[model samples]
Target: MLRTGEQYRDSIRDGRRVWINGERVQDITKHPMFKPMIDVRARIYDMAHDDATRDVMSYEENGERFSVGLKLPYTKDDWHAKRRATDTVLEDIGGVVTRVGDETAGEMWSLYDGQDILNEVDPRFSTNIRNHIHHVIKTDPFHVSANTDPKGDRSKRPQDQDPDMLLHVVKETDAGIIVRGAKYETAAAYANQAFTKPTIANWGNEAMSDYAVGFVCDFSSPNLRFIARTGFAGRAPARDYPLSNKFDEVETLVVYDNVLIPWENVLFYQHTKAATFIRATLHRYSAFAFVQRNLKLADMLIGAALWNVRQTGLEHQPAVQEKLATLACYREGINAHLTAAIADAEESPGGLLMPNQSLLMTGRVLACSQLHHMMHIARELCGGQICITPDVASFEDPEAGPWLDKFYTLNENWASEDRRKLLAYARDLLNSDYAGHRLTFQLFAQSPPFAHLAAVYRNFDWNEALRFTHKSAGLSDQVWGDKR
Candidate 1:
């Protein structure tokens, strides 16, 4: 079920409810801002067919070949290998920042969805679970997992809010259930074929039964509409802003107006405990996907920073050399965590490989650290050029051309215009709203920093290390609590 970019585009072009300002988008593909993002995502599909990336984008299984996506590996080694493959694919594409399709979101979603149903299988439902996996692999449909409910107030329960504020089963028919409500900030929803679950909502004891449901449906199924995101970043001109042209991030409000799902697609309904259990477990595995995403972005930043060092003719300066070293350290730290987690994966009950939780958690904790430091290093090494550089268009102006050429000139090692182009790219990243938006999302999307640290403190076993230290200090290991 390999989809070309255009094929993916045409699938979602059926007049979804997309509005910016006051007008609804008639055609998402031709929309000025949305088109660039679609094109970038198309390139990701094209990479699968590319000679350079084909090896990384696909893998061999049982004498047959399959696309290596967010695939569920049969063993721990295969799991790490998949991560390596994801990194390689992302590198060839220059990074994972702007595009919608990077294999992380969909691959993991399918894996978790399959595992959830398998966990509670009676013979009949178990067979249904297996069939869904086969269907996904054969069709290779695009999927986005919707977990966040657009809560009216963070403190209130789903029942406390207006019932319509939450997405819940409104009616159960012999055929399937009908769902109404919305999920917001659904990344890749515009191009996805379906949405998967554990629904993230406060289903108080009373609301639990109706809310604790998981299922699948076609993206183009009746009564669904996408309210596309709008702003300077989303609406920037394509020709004038080449980087923004493809791979724009789209946030959509997925409105489910009485959508129906057949009996087979319903994984959990009326089992509130099962829903919570599935949510906790999936959150654990999603750490692997996050590592894949962060590593890809860090690699891109490293390339940009190194190029900036040379472009500014400061590559040899002591200060610049030190900044590059710090940048390299960030890259090495993230890769090291990912490597260690892979090296220690354990097989789970549901026939899937799970990352070592402590190592994976450590990886999550350090994730933002690496990114923050990369931004700091970029500022130190790149200089004001990232913020003050002239636009690519300035060269076209007769009055500005002579001054642009004269002042923008670099040393004999590189042409001034060439240097300017690279700096301009960095400038767009650092000086524009893109940088701030990234920071906001990074903090906003994550749990509180202290909550993460507390999990690390509680979940990791430090007894072995503590015993070793006490013995090294010439004290008996007995000073410590039971080795058990």
Candidate 2:
């Protein structure tokens, strides 16, 4: 069922204990740093009820309305609908937001795809995953993922360092399992729940271990705290840092001090195979949304760069046009991957339609790996004025206003106010401290570059290349150990 914006705000006002900037966040919906994103999330919910967006954001099933984002994608049409819903929210909000409900809801679907693996571990565990998927659809709770733990020492085993380094099942109770440790979650502070699981670990040696556990952690549970990174919002004037003020999806280090996970919420437990399978396939569905964000980012880069060039009449230059083309190519490259992935989508083991693995994984690698270089190109195209520009206050100063206005005015089209705003926007998008953090987030957010390549390695059709090479080289039948 769909909810209104006010309803979503009231839900996160559950009095969950949260801290940011070394102080308790009494009300996230009211806090300067958290409010913008929370409101954005709420607007996403409200869109499903608004007359203009309701048709796109929600679907009718048995005369009841449900969020298209939370709908389990079983048909090609379902995926198309989901894509349109996400795009609608982004366009409506006027910027990109990755951790908003739609992007994260797919992580649960990835686990849903692993039902067979989960069933092998325990039938009840598999049942838990399906129920949670249904729960998301029915309740439309804002779900997030929790995978990475504070692995105290990279070389030392979790037991060798601090047993609590990696999140583990400390104790089990009839009511639920008590878990201990912390996870780095992007939007857990204000979100409803998280699909908590193990990080990348050597789990094959263990047949049974406490570290192998996965559950849906209700954020309102006791003994949990969300310590978020200091946000970019309220740090400066919104005019100076538009993207930072509104679009930062604050990352939080959530500490679970022996939190309880009820039996119904536990998706997998004890078995190493279950943990391993989840780690390998975690982003199978979620990566699509994650990479889609990069597409929006490319657009932002191109827009900022193109506007700056046009303000100075550099658009006619071949060199400038070539760089603009490069950014466009990068943007469309992501578009092509996303489009073709849906076209060549494959059925999951659990019968859900998944984007073609090779394309999706490689697309993620391409989108994320080259983000830094693309940002640099855009920065170069924007010229040195983006960084050397004066503040808004200077432009408005009585003494300085006329002088600044005279110089900043470039022909009748571009004026001082518009130029200052463009430079400010470009500065925040490309050159500020917030920009660096966002770049780091893109590189490591959805696993590292190495892991992206590993996914490609696992899913790519290597046999096709091997078969081609064999035929081209005319290898003897006996030389190759084959069924033929």
Candidate 3:
């Protein structure tokens, strides 16, 4: 059964211990800072009922097709449906706001939540996965997010940092284990419905092995505390601000003070060998998902920019047309890589369908870099009108209205007020103190561009690359002169 938008609202209406600026939020569903974000999430729920999205957003449960994400076909056709659904959701979100703790994030985690036990206990990890699938089919779990604690300095190993800085299994019991410490940048944790598997440990020290543990838990689990960050878009006044009026993008510092995890939610507990495998496998899937999400965002931005261009009568301008083309190219490039990844997807040993690691990583790398470059192009194309646009307040003044109308006339065809609205929306996106600088920040922060590039280069099979290069140059695969 799919959860309806109203059902989603009901789920978060009460029993949530969410705090924004030291005040307990009784109803995130109605809170000004959270309502728009929640509304966008509800729209995702509405997707399941959408005529165009039903095929991908909802799956009929046949006895044979046990899992949702994996029960689907491993084909480009399937990828298209998923992309459509993702695009539908992202398009509804005009701000940085997200229900990261919502259904999508939970569904991703449940994909691997009971993974290790599947081979021996449940045999498919399908029970909970299906429940989650149905849940998302309705409301999308309301909120979900992941955390990967690098711990201290990047140059140091996890063991080198204060052990508590990373979440780890401190004690194991017959029923469960206790975990302590914290993970930085657990985005959307404050509002997400579920917590994802923590980071896998990669260190030389034996004491740090507990840090490799993985588990799923509710957001309000005992001993959990949220340290909130300042507003990005959701903090602005309702009437005038462009993006903030419609969205709230929030992040938090999640502190775990001896949290307990039931054995049922524990996916991999200090099985370091398997932990490494799960980590790498999840990394591949995350990259694939990011490619799809970021591409949709880029494509959406392109449409918005081009729409403003046409509305402002700048479409005929040579320079404006050139900038739009570049934006379009970035969109197409991301699509190409995403398609290539889907085309090359493989089935993991655990029976989960996953994409090509190298392709997805390369796409993520390109996404961050391209997104930054694209936003720069948008800023340049829009000119100072984006930054210096008059406050929406001036429109209320009778005397100023005529002056604004005369001086800001793009053309006599469209009314000045209408044009002002579009400009305000554009400025909301391109010029706001939060929206402008933060778009680049999210893109860069998704994965460090430089580290991603290094990983791609390191993972590249140079011999295979050279072989392809030679083949492309019309030489045989053996052009390297090593027949062996």
Best by TM-score: 2
Clashing pairs in 1: 36-245
**What are the per-residue Cα lDDT tens digits for candidate 1 across 225-333?**
6776664444454333444444446667788889897878766666665565555455456566666677766766767788887776778988788888877777777
| lDDT of each residue in 327-381, candidate 2, tens digit only | 9999999999999889999999889999999999989998998899999999999
Candidate 1 lDDT score at position 68: 64
Question: Model 1: residues >4 Å from true position, as ranges?
Answer: 50-52, 60-65, 97-129, 198-207, 231-242, 444-459, 462-484
Quote the lDDT for 419 in model 1.
71
Ordering by TM-score: 2, 1, 3
In terms of lDDT, the best-performing candidate is 2
Estimate TM-scores for all models: 0.85, 0.98, 0.81
When summed lDDT is taken over every stretch of 10 residues in candidate 1, the lowest stretch is 98-107
Q: Candidates 1 and 3: which is better by TM-score?
A: 1
List clashing residue pairs in candidate 2.
none
Evaluate residue 307 in candidate 2 and report its C-alpha lDDT on the 0 to 100 scale: 93
